[model samples]
Target: MPSRTEAKGVEAISSDGNLSTVHAQTSRKERPPVDSQDGWNGTLQQSEAMAPVYDWGPEIQGIILSSCNYASFLVPIPTGYIAGIFGAKYLVGVNLLLSSVLALLIPLAADAGVLSITVLRIAQGIAQVMVFTSQFSLWVKWAPPLEKNQLINIAISGHLMGSFITLLIGGFLCQTKVWPSIFYIFGGIGCAYSFLWFLLVYDDPIHHQFISAGEKEYIVCSLAQQGCSPGWSLPIKAMIKSLPLWGILVFHFTEFWIFNILVAYLPTYINSVLQANFRDSGILSALLLGAACIGTILGGLLVDFLHSRKIFRLVTIRKLSTAIGVLVPSVVFVSLHWVRFSFSASMGLLALSSVTSTFCQTGALVNILDIAPRYTSFLQGLSEVFAYSSGAISSTVAGFLISQDSEFGWRNVFLIAVSINMSGLVFYLIFGQAKVQDWATEQMFTQL
Candidate 1:
């Protein structure tokens, strides 16, 4: 079973494998993906499963799958600086090319035994970050404002789908001794995506000739209302000082910590602790992720509905979601200590906890865009940094805690996760608000 970090940044379709809210600058020579028919608009028009090009056969598909996992590890480290300084186009281009190159190296690295499994994992992690970040950045550039939520959901769903397919089908493939075929398949797909991406994708809508004038007008108007500039640098200080940014960071950190622990380690926990079979573990893992997929879409719809009705502000909606979402799972974690049930019953409790907690994950992701539309990508990257960092910590700590037990003992780990979830909820309620920052407002006024 892959760790949560392997599934990191699996939620949103932002350039960083997380949610980022930023405006894309455009030039006539460089059109953004949103503007092209094959961009976000085109993608969302189809089913979420087939939205991204994840169907390039088993080997390449597995590479893309692993790449998705790998990117979750790599995105946060370099995404913010790259997007902030170089702009989204170069960021996307460099990342796409780099990820493909590095991914192809995995086979060679393995055959030569030049690196340990851990080091090879790290390399895959780096490639995952680059590829997803680039893909997300391009999506942000091309996707229209009104469709942002749905499009982002679809984009992120690709990862969920990937995980689901891998678990369900990967085992069979491996049983057939075609395991290496997975990586080879993904490598070939990566090369193909690079070629098509270079030819079809642009930096912004204004530069794309294929986009009609009416479509551009609709996009511009929608973005304006969402606090985005069509093609300008963001007010860096305002974004830096925003309270919502910090709120999002904390929220995402907590959500990812729980998610990472479960997704990465749950299989082992079930097998080692509950003494479940491999098939059972795989099924439970898929259910956990499937719950997350459902939670993400439902959470988005709920938040969007609330925002539309003006019943609560976006920030308040996010807070409410986080509180309810985190609170439920924290209670479940505590209950786990008392439950003397069969393994199936335990799995039921865990799956329920996962489904509810996932609401917080989607909420925090959408909030990144809500709070800082101008620098959504960079801010999200910042949040990813913290989220993934927590994931690394959780991974190491969970391993240590579980190892200390002679038998199936995960009580300490659950207690720790419960504490983290509760703390995140409290922090969010106390400090998180969706309104634009005072400094950002001032900066906007000054610019005007």
Candidate 2:
């Protein structure tokens, strides 16, 4: 199975607007026929090199693939507003449906050439941004205070799992005669899940058809105490002026820079530097992400446990986890260059970096709920604009930085990533907020 890292790399290609080099190969020599009397298989195998059929070159490929990330810069903010006004269930459902359809159409788009595929990827990016905005919007209505980190962390961890499953399975599938099956299988699964989501999930507990009466009442009463209610305007002016909000944006942006570098290029690093074959590269990449999944779950549990016991104040815990999660990884990432001669050791360090770094899922990610549960979705959306934008830049930037494919080029990329990660941590440590903002409640509006 391909690793989650490889899956993430693939997603980076699709979502972040990076072009994977498609080698255009010459026709393969015909294979010797198997003898019918020898009990050999009779089926003719398709050559793996026959796929990737187009070689648009780096320049054209980058322009086309990057449409997804560039289009993302326009979608999340508006989608968040739409989700807030119209409710998230339908928005999420529609986004899923669109993404699924786009996935299924990739082969056809590729056949039609670069422009067609680029347009399709742009549409998919639009759908993806809406999906994230709407999902976080749903959290505004659904997550209870005590369980906030746990719920959000678990939900986010599912992304890790999805990445893991896709990369692993896709790796094996890519080596098969039917490489296109990777898209068909995953897209079909997404379509099926969308149907289930529509049927089983509700916008809020109040409207849920199957939620127990007691549980619904408990949820309503809990939210009421925290001044969570519909009809609150999205405090646009306040959000713009808030230092803490900007802190979150910085945190998100810097964090994703490192993330983009890894997801988009880790497999390439393993292949080019470590000299691992395609299959091994995929497996090693998956192991790194699998470590991240573990870290996510453990980090969430640690936060919730500390919160429950009041072992540390909420702000303290958030900051501490962010430091531990982010800083260690930055250090490990820099140190990776020194150990390049030992492939197994380098892989181990990479996995450790991923594991420790994922604790941020429980830190700043859930911090949105802490400070502005009412506008968690909007806040997350706003931050994601910066994050995805940085993600896009990182891909382009990495391409330029590593153009030489030398150790010097790769080292510079890691150093830049490390520097960004540390800077974000410092910024957030100084300015990050955990207290619920006054603007989240009715009193602030009354004053307005």
Candidate 3:
């Protein structure tokens, strides 16, 4: 009997090597292997080089696979606050170190048993939370307003490209007969990255000795008028009352819901529905995510161009980009149900969705930096909670639905994701704003 280490295989580490998200089933069908296009059964067969096969049912599988996110939910708020008070530099570096070390140990932990692997993954998740929140915290001072979209999207695109490397390279690695090399190689790279980060990354342009005086002055002056940095005190009451904050939160939830669904279930869909093998599923997922990486860079450039040129108000830009991200994906997902019989068609739709959804990278995502740079880190933490909740809920729900009936289960998942996404778009369009809020200014908080 294979232990729960099989569940660890479900984790998808982000490209930067700093974050990991749970999704996918590595279990192949055992006994009578179900026909690829028909149903799913846990595969209990594997060569000695690969990890042991486990027959975890959908319920247990969902629980163990998503355990990392459970820990992620607990860390973001406090860490984000701390990072604001102290600095994100040490927080991010330390978290990445922990995550990298743990990745190297996964194989040994799997050999130990279920408890070890679960605990290790949870630890890694906590690290992931800090890495995410810290970046948003640093961006409070590190990124000038004009460069917000391009800089942030480019940074995030690193993670996507890393994911592309992980998936595509992982497929080839699996074929090498030494599966654990996947962890050893990536973990080593992450460790190496930590050194580069400590050496190169600064909390702000003001602190970087290598930057030119003119550039630093430009960066500082552009940001001088805004109260976007983390403060000693937050306007909790005002923030709670603000529709724009709520709008960003709701939009984050919606975006995460759809993204998480794809993250957690795409491989299962490919295996059970499309009948593709593990390697093929990974290659396809990697390819689609690569498209998203490209889309993110392009969208950021487009959004910034429009904003810089004064062609649209910041609010209008957000709403327009967000509409494309939401409505297009919804349509594609719905179309998926109709065209699912054709494997190539389904992949193409998913690829399209992957690219279109990235427009929100500039929309709701960058909106926080615009409206309240002061609390961007904390808000990102708040949003992380929402993001993790949606992912956890959606992954479990997906498991339940798929268990009831494989075909209809997927249809329900897509429809549910689409409906939730649409409502978020509506709320954001009505309430989301981009101009700096009065309460976000240092004077307003001090006066209050």
Clashing pairs in 3: 15-162, 28-43, 29-43, 228-373, 228-374
Q: What is the lDDT of candidate 2?
A: 0.68
Candidate 3, after superposition: displacement of residue 205 in Å?
1.5
lDDT (C-alpha) at residue 18 in model 1: 12
Candidate 2 residues 107-173, lDDT tens each? 7787787789878978887887788777777666666677667666666776666666655555445
Give the winner by TM-score: 2 or 3: 3
TM-score for candidate 3, residues paired by index: 0.89
What residue pairs are clashing in model 2?
A: 2-168, 3-286, 4-286
lDDT: worst 10-residue window of model 2? 1-10
- Indicate the residue-level lDDT of 437 in model 3: 87
Instruction: Give per-model TM-scores.
Output: 0.73, 0.87, 0.89
TM-score of 2: 0.87
Question: Which lDDT values do the candidates have, in the order given?
Answer: 0.53, 0.68, 0.72
- Can you rank all candidates by TM-score, best first? 3, 2, 1
